[model samples]
Target: MEREIFPWIGASRGTSILISKKKSFHYTDVIANNSSRYIIVSGIPQHRKITLINIYAPNSGQLVGDPILLGGDMNLVNNPLLDRSSRPLPADAALSTALDELQRLLRVTDVW
Candidate 1:
């Protein structure tokens, strides 16, 4: 099944998750906004819960679980010096700081 969340005004900006029916996982909760979507699912066999988050920008939120994975096009970079070829923008620096704090709070590792 294809799950999509579009902005209230239109579908110009949105995120989608395609789940196969044959998969042994089903979604239990979903939280979405104009720029982000969060889905919690449980594996049928192991009954392990997982939270998946997709984001388009910097948005603060929380999820509780042993393992959580996030995929996004956030404009923020972890290390500007290594990630960027030019000088870091002010806006990006702020967002990067916010992202760092969020990651620390969530105790999640950046796989970038």
Candidate 2:
């Protein structure tokens, strides 16, 4: 698939837009869009439409709604020792807690 850009105007740090696509990922109808900080989409599969949300969430992940695929650059680490670029840094308790909550919220494998 190729990128499509259209006339867009003022919005916040994140925005959601919708586009209709003929087919994608086993779905005959797909709708998707991206913003400065997130991407959101819905696909009609098996006669039902489900959503996937991609975000650059702030500290808390800010998860809402039930989504089939929830994705983002959450800046969280399941294993701090291995996730950093170089030397490991100490984990922030709050971020860890938030990430844990996000994990529980999604209830799925967190691998990319």
Choose the strongest candidate by TM-score: 1
Residue pairs clashing, model 1: none
Expressed as tens digits, the lDDT of each residue in 3-47 for candidate 1 is: 332233334544555555556655666666544443333323247
Worst 10 residues of 2 by lDDT: 1-10
**TM-score of every model?**
0.38, 0.35
Error of 1 at 100 (Å): 0.4
Q: Which ten residues in a row have the lowest lDDT in candidate 1?
A: 36-45
lDDT of 2 by residue, 61-93 (tens): 564553556555777776565666766555655
Clash numbers, per candidate: 0, 0
What's the C-alpha lDDT at position 90 in model 1? 72
How big is the positional error of residue 36 in model 2, measured in Å on the Cα after superposition?
A: 15
Q: Judge candidate 2 at residue 101 and give its lDDT.
A: 85
